[model samples]
Target: MNAAPADQIRLLDVQAFDVRLQQLAHRRKSLPEHTEIQSLTKDLTQMRDLLVAAQTEESDCAREQTKAEQDVDQVRTRAARDQQRLDSGAVTSPKDLAGLQHEITSLAKRQGDLEDVVLEVMERRESAQERVAELTERVSSVQAKADDAVARRDAACEELDGEAASVAKEREVVAGVVPADLIALYDKLRAQQGGIGAAKLYQRTCQGCRQELAITELAEIRSAAPDTVVRCENCRRILVRTSESGL
Candidate 1:
């Protein structure tokens, strides 16, 4: 609204700066590292769950092995006492000798069964231990990858932050030169048009929509007072014409 020719051109710089800032922000959000970090975070959670399950299984196996060992020791102790009694030959009655012999045979069978169970428990314990080890290693690997992804994401954000900061400074400097009403209009339009309020008019084409202007529209735009702000017919974006526009 009533901006001088030079002022209108300067407003283009402000619009350009805003557009660049928007692009930078979009790039920051869409970085490949961001997606990768998200995926890695999910994987880390799964790995942690697997590690916990493996550790629990390992603990259960250890407990079973301990109980099996205790059973073996108890059976062995009973068998030793029985052997001592048999060797001493203290039993004189035939019935008593037969009972002792039968008791010894039952004890021997129990000892063999307990030994086999103990061996099986030991094997299961070993397998459980191996699973725990594998899970530990896998969790560590996922953690390392997640850490790397975080670092990469941080670096990318830092770069974008720096670029946005510089552009913000430039935008502020340009804002001081543009009229308040024009800036207000640009801000409102930017909010409505997805952060792009202005486009360069090149060879009668609206850069925003990449569409050619009608002959009558082009003539009116070219003949209009330089101080008047023009909106593209196709895209409704503020058209800033320059020498490079070939208009």
Candidate 2:
């Protein structure tokens, strides 16, 4: 394949732009906000789970307290009824009256036990409520951090995308002036050679491979026509000659 000397130089400009676009893409991926967002998202998930668990516990405790208070009320009502019956002489027989008084005493003790249960349930419910509140706040805090990180990542990516778009446009303009056959060859070689299809021959060295051309190779290049397209033997890339080629 052959291209004019000026066309080969323009190919280098296209390569430079391609390299810049690649760097921009790398910067976009490597932004710190990406990792920050990931870590924060994990923490947010865990916090939300804890908040849900705490809310469930609080709800359970509330139901338990209500049931305990109801039991206390029932026991107290029974004890009051039993005392009234004894006081009104409803049980005149000595044995019956004594039995009635004993029954009242047992009812009083039962009411006291039920009241204690209500108090215990109240304490537990209060603790559960506090835990739910704390977890809720923590979840909100973590969620806020995650949102901020995502915003930062988006902003950085937008900036990089803008720059990459501009560089791509410049590459297109530069490549448009080159012959289609030459561009096709460059693209093929670029795909095969790690992003570098053409390189400058400077001071007797192939910049693509960083190797000095042997005496015979230099002799051959020196004898080649000025408009001839030459390739480096070491790296198999198009070698564009310049005044600094030391040939």
Candidate 3:
């Protein structure tokens, strides 16, 4: 396939735009914020799980403390009733009075033990609450970081998309001027060759593969017509000749 010299040069412009678009796409994918967000998301998941566990523990502790306090209250009430009975002359028999006093003493001990249980439960609940608070703060902090990373990633993508849009439009316009056959061939070669369908023959080297054309290759290229589409033997990419192409 052959295209005019100017058309071939325009193909280079098209290639440049394509290269820029490729770079923009790569930059968008490889944004540092992407990795940062990923890592932060993992941390956030772990933190959220821990927060949930802590909250569950706190809730359980709260219920336990309530139950313990209720037990203490019940024991205290029983002890108070027994003491009242003992102080009054309700038990007229001396043996009955002694039994009542003994019963009161046992109730007092039971109340004290229940109260100690309440205190222990209170301490555990307090610890659980502190853990919940700490976990909550950590979750919030990680969530904030994740949010920030997401924002940054979005902003970067927006910027890159805008630039890519502009470049793509320009590529469309530039490619419009080239011959359909040449464009088709270039597209096919580009797909086959790592995004580069055409390259400049600078000095004596094929820019696509960075290989210097052999003497015979240069001789043939030098003899080819100006409008002839020549491909580099080394890379099989269209070699656009310029004045600097040291024939």
Candidate 4:
């Protein structure tokens, strides 16, 4: 189809804007912040898991400590009752008294052992609580980082979107200059030619296909009218000639 030489050249502007828009879109999706966000999200998940485990351990340890302390209390209460009975001279039989005294000694040893168990459990519980606290703090720290990463990722995307909006507006203006039929052709070719509908004929090569045209084809293109829309014999994309086309 015949379009003004200047109009055909304007099609290149549309192509340029479209390509820039594509690049901007790609940049928005492939930002480094996107990768950072993914990594931060993964860390947040792992950190939460660790915190949960720590909380479970602390709770279990606390229960064990309570039971241990109760065990020690029960042993001490029994020992106290035995001591009181021995002091009151309740067991008047000499053999019974001797047995009561021996029973008191054994109760004292048992109380000591239970107290030792309570101390060990308390220490373990305390350590588990400390671990929970540490993990909680770490989770908060990593959560803050993840939030920052999300903010950064969002901001970067917004900036790219804003730029793309501006480029799109420019593309609309550039596209308005070309005739409807030419745009239809360009759109069709763009769909078929990997998003490149037209390319500059730089030197002797068709930039769209990056191939040099045969001399016979070059001669025909040179001989064609200035208003003619030349297509590459190799790629069939509209070849927009320029001063550098070496026609």
Every model's TM-score: 0.91, 0.91, 0.95, 0.90
Per residue, candidate 3 scores C-alpha lDDT tens digits across 1-247 of: 7789999999999999989989999999999998999999999899888888888888988898888888888878887887888777687898988888888888888888888888888888888889889988988898998999999999999999999999999999999999999999999999999999999999999999999999999999999999999999988999999999998
Steric clashes per prediction: 0, 0, 0, 0
The residue pairs in collision within model 2 are none
Worst 10 residues of 4 by lDDT: 119-128
C-alpha local distance difference test of each model: 0.86, 0.89, 0.91, 0.89
Candidate achieving the largest lDDT: 3
**RMSD (CA, Å), each prediction:** 1.9, 1.9, 1.4, 2.0
Candidate 1 per-residue lDDT, tens place, 93-136, comes to 89988988898899899989998998998898888889889888
Candidate 1 error regions (>4 Å): 244-247
- What is the alpha-carbon lDDT for the whole of candidate 2? 0.89
**Arranged by TM-score, best first:** 3, 1, 2, 4
Clashing pairs in 1: none
Per-residue C-alpha lDDT of model 2 across residues 105-181, encoded as one tens digit per residue = 89888888888888888888898899998988888888888888898899889999999999999999999999998
Q: With candidate 3 superimposed using the best TM-score fit, by how many Å does residue 80's alpha carbon deviate from the native?
A: 1.8
